[model samples]
Every structure is written in C-alpha cells, then in structure tokens.
Target: MALIKCSECGKEISDTVESCVHCGCPLGKVIFNTGNSWIGVFGKYIITDESGNVLAKLKENQQFEMNIVEDTTFYVQCNTSIRRNKVKVCVPAGEINKFLVKLGFLGIVTVVSKID
Candidate 1:
C-alpha cells in the first residue's frame, strides 16, 4: 500500500485507508491529490438569458470564484474596452464543453480592431 498525505489533518496514512486515522476524515478516491491544490481551470462562464443583461463578470487579476464542474460554464467578460484583451481563461476538469454551449462563447475571442 502506498502512503498518502491526509488532506484534513496533514498526517501521513495508507492509501488503502478510507479516512484519516488521525482526524477521521473521509479518504475516498476523489480525495487523491485533489484537495487545496490550484487546479488552474474553470468549467464555464455564466451569462444572462435574454435582453443581454451582464450578470457575472470575470475581471483581470481576480481568482475565479465558481466551482469547476463537468459541463460547467461561466460568463467570461468580453467588452469593447481595451482592458479585455488576451484574457487567459481556464476551464476546470469536466466542465469545458458545457460552458461553451451555455454561454455561446464558441468563437476564439480576439481584439480584431480596437475601436478608439
């Protein structure tokens, strides 16, 4: 059996163990190397239903707030402002395609012509 670190109590334990013997935390397969680590991805962007109302916004230098889920999508902010150029977007595990369909963010967003 491999030794794994307990995400809850920060103690060492056997991988076969279900929970941390020290803190009694649940140790499932999902817990393997997936806790408190920066996944560096997002599922999708959230958008308005109609009337083009801007609901959620993704700003520069801001850590994404929504949980990345399968088929999850967020509303990435692309505006007519120069500040919205070359924004690095991250899609978390299991939520890439779903986010694209919901938000209709299919095309590659680029600064075609900066209208001054």
Candidate 2:
C-alpha cells in the first residue's frame, strides 16, 4: 500500500488505511489501481532517469507528440499480470559520434574513409 499525505495535517498515512494516525483525520475513500498491470490498455507507464520513480500515467488512446526532454527508459508491458513484467529500452542522445568512439566503431569508419 502506498502512503499518501493527509490533506488537513499534511501527515503521511497509508493509502490502504482509513484515517491518519497523527491528526486522527479521516482519509475518506481510497482507490488503488489494481488493474491487470501497470501498463494496461488504457494507460502507459512513462519512466525517466531524472527521477527513480514513476513520472505519470498517460491517458488511454491519447495522441500527442512530445519531444523527450532527456534520455528516458520506458518499461512497457508485453502482457497483463500482477507481477508487471516488462521490457526496458534505453534512448540515447542524438550525439552519436561520442557513442561510436566509445564502442570502438570509429576505427571502422576511419578505415572505410581511407579506402574511399
């Protein structure tokens, strides 16, 4: 169960709990997203390396083109399950020259350029 802050006292309380322990305030009703998976048909998990946590949940069938602010790794679900197994893919920066040099592929380019 996730912990949410109480609106009145600003105290942290369990989302599964019914009330706040600090101020004895009622948390009203709470709902946990016990869907088939985090990556349900109606939502997608958008992860970012900037924060080691969930950024936000996208709406279902929402179509909007957004430029990635930075390098991000999205864990998309391939199937529905409570375990939430996913595949991770990394997005690299547009500066490919440094990456090629790091991977030792720059030598190949130099050799080919000399032949040409």
Best prediction by lDDT: 1
Off by over 4 Å in 2: 1-51, 63-71, 77-80, 95-116
Q: What number of clashing residue pairs does each candidate have, in the order they appear?
A: 14, 0
The local lDDT score (0 to 100) that residue 31 gets in candidate 1 is: 9
Q: Candidate 1's residue-wise lDDT over 1-116, tens digit each?
A: 77767766788887666567898776532100111222124522323323445445333222223322122222343443324333323333322122221111243342211111
Q: Name every residue pair that clashes in candidate 2.
A: none
What value of lDDT does candidate 1 attain over all alpha carbons? 0.36
How much is the lDDT of residue 102 in candidate 2? 8
TM-score of 1: 0.26
User: What C-alpha lDDT, on a 0 to 100 scale, does residue 80 get in candidate 1?
Assistant: 31
